[model samples]
Target: MAMFVHLTSAANAPGVRRSGIRAASHGQGSARGVYCFPVLPSYTLTHQWLRELARFGSRGGLVAVHVRLDDAQEVLVGRYAERARMAQVVVSAAEAVRRIAALEDPRGWEVFVPRAIRPREVHRVRTAPQVTGWRYLPDAHGARPCTCFGCRVRGGYGARRLRERLPHPLDGPPPPVRVLLAQVAAGDPGDAAALREALHWFSMRRRGPLDRLAGLATHPDPGVREDLVWAVAGWSTPGVTELLDGLADDPDADVREAVEAARDPIS
Candidate 1:
């Protein structure tokens, strides 16, 4: 069972009027009573409030904080949403409404939820009543469309109306080897384009020139080291396997994994 808690104002009269919503907007009062509810945009809350909210989430409590892109804040990846350390289920408000309506709940929150969502309920677990697939249905009706993670993510609506901003560049000839190597040596953390182009130099055109980048084996950046591992794969260059063997115990775990993977590309 999914739950919603709309955040709205106290001055614009009756705040949120939906089922399970709370009405505590920006200016409720300086010293306000605290509710034990999971907060939306919990990142911006006071230290105490944030701690309490995080605690709720830690003990098997629901961590479904929904938000809409009303402004231009970039959606953070790995650090926010699905991959956030605490948040279990985060999505947008409009998507939540659509999903909730499909619950087919005979006597769920729809029975108690006001015509307006009252954001006041503290969330716990959200287990469904049962699970029935197409094979189990009496009429042999097929299961609902695949709402698996990959499909659902790909099914999300795109802003097709937005104009394309980037220019379409034609593929040009590769730069001379010396210039490419210079770029690779100068690559920095902020920009890996130079290093990537160098990797492209080795990957394409049936070339197996692994010896050219042998000096880069001890490059500081693990990313560069990892890329070198890939570039050397299937190249049959003499002493290349020995070099990779030395890097098998790379300091960076990712680099070590990359080295292991390169050891046997066919397998």
Candidate 2:
């Protein structure tokens, strides 16, 4: 939701000069939409470094700039300073110092620095957290994992029943719930894209004995229903599309919009 970028102490100041060079990329998967945040102390905040970070973030890198604002500076209160989809500011210097002082996970490597990008010893800087996201569904009834957008948003009574049968495990393992909550809090675009993709994929595999999505369509959760409305529009399958098309006249305005998005030629 709120992305963070951590710049190393050496490069934390706003006025620090950048070499105008690109840092070495860590391999493709290493770059799975995650950015390295450099961690530094609050006193390191310089105009040059901040400007460089803002510039880097604008180019699609998530950045975590460390800031140790006093109780009155209110560092975390500002809206994000950059406009990149893949960017964020993190107050990591304070976090790192706090954690270190508290003897918590003293491993220095926690502050990541992409190995490939350093131009020189001075250019070597540490980075930020490697965060990933996913939304979880239950294995109740031992249901196979599915991400059909149509099932998530369409189908109908049967689909809703199926979803209820396999409702999300809200209190199970902490990871999925944590990720889900973080996504909700951050309004993450990548997370949103992943959800849409997963639902679409699950929706397309339905030539079987049970219509999974048709079951989810009637899911009682208003949140689930809202998700479905968005998911159904991206589904390209004719069968799924046709099914949604029929719901265009459904009494619910959101449901009708989803159906129209699915079936309307001009949409």
Candidate 3:
């Protein structure tokens, strides 16, 4: 048998002890399962998820549930960063343990068992140090964070403050429509960076001088043209739809993708 540990809320301890750790999806897909880490010789490494899980504000603190599973049992394993993309592979329980243990830095690794752990498979539920693992990402301390709108969650802890400290070029409150138009008009078409920035500001504000901005559809830089699609996506003005329809056939894949994303309400 291979040993593994699952960190969960202490509030569920009674139910967990009465039964076993129930299988549930961790926002990846419809496949419900219990998540665990291979038990390593190093105590801190074995419980590396404790601190990260606590960030979710688990009530009553958290506990570690040790489990035993057959070495031949199949499980899904992948890097924590790829979990949202469902980029995992099926491997035997023992193989998962060996693979993680062999990694020089196994900080972001995770395993997903496809079924509930039976009571007999549970070894014990015990108290764990609340501050044992890396938060955000492994070794993320002192690393510059990506403050893009997609990277930082709205209203998340420290998100507002972090954005204020380090604003992303493509994020934050956009300038007024008139200001963006003047910037775009005065910007050198050869200067892709400046043109892209002004266009991106228009994208954020979702309104601009459509006729003036539309001329950039033929800009040499595909990035500028891509930003053009986003800039006009929210416009209800006449000729906007026709302009977007023309952009839909852009030779650049990124520009075409931007056009498709712009047309989709949920994209």
The best candidate in terms of TM-score:
3
Which lDDT tens digits does candidate 1 get at residues 196-245?
Answer: 66775554323455566776677777787788777775465677778788
Error of 2 at 136 (Å): 30
Give the range where candidate 3 is weakest over 10 consecutive residues by summed lDDT: 258-267
User: lDDT tens digits, residues 143-162, model 3?
Assistant: 99878754555456897789
TM-score of candidate 2 versus the correct structure, residues matched by position:
0.22
**Each prediction's whole-model lDDT (CA):** 0.39, 0.35, 0.81
The TM-score of predicted model 1 comes to: 0.32
For model 2, where is the 10-residue window of minimal lDDT?
71-80
Window of ten residues with lowest summed lDDT in model 1: 106-115
lDDT of 2: 0.35
**TM-scores, one per candidate:** 0.32, 0.22, 0.59
Task: Candidate 1: list runs displaced more than 4 Å.
Answer: 1-176, 185-192, 205-209
**Candidate 2 off by > 4 Å:** 1-210, 232-238, 265-267
RMSD of 1: 19.0
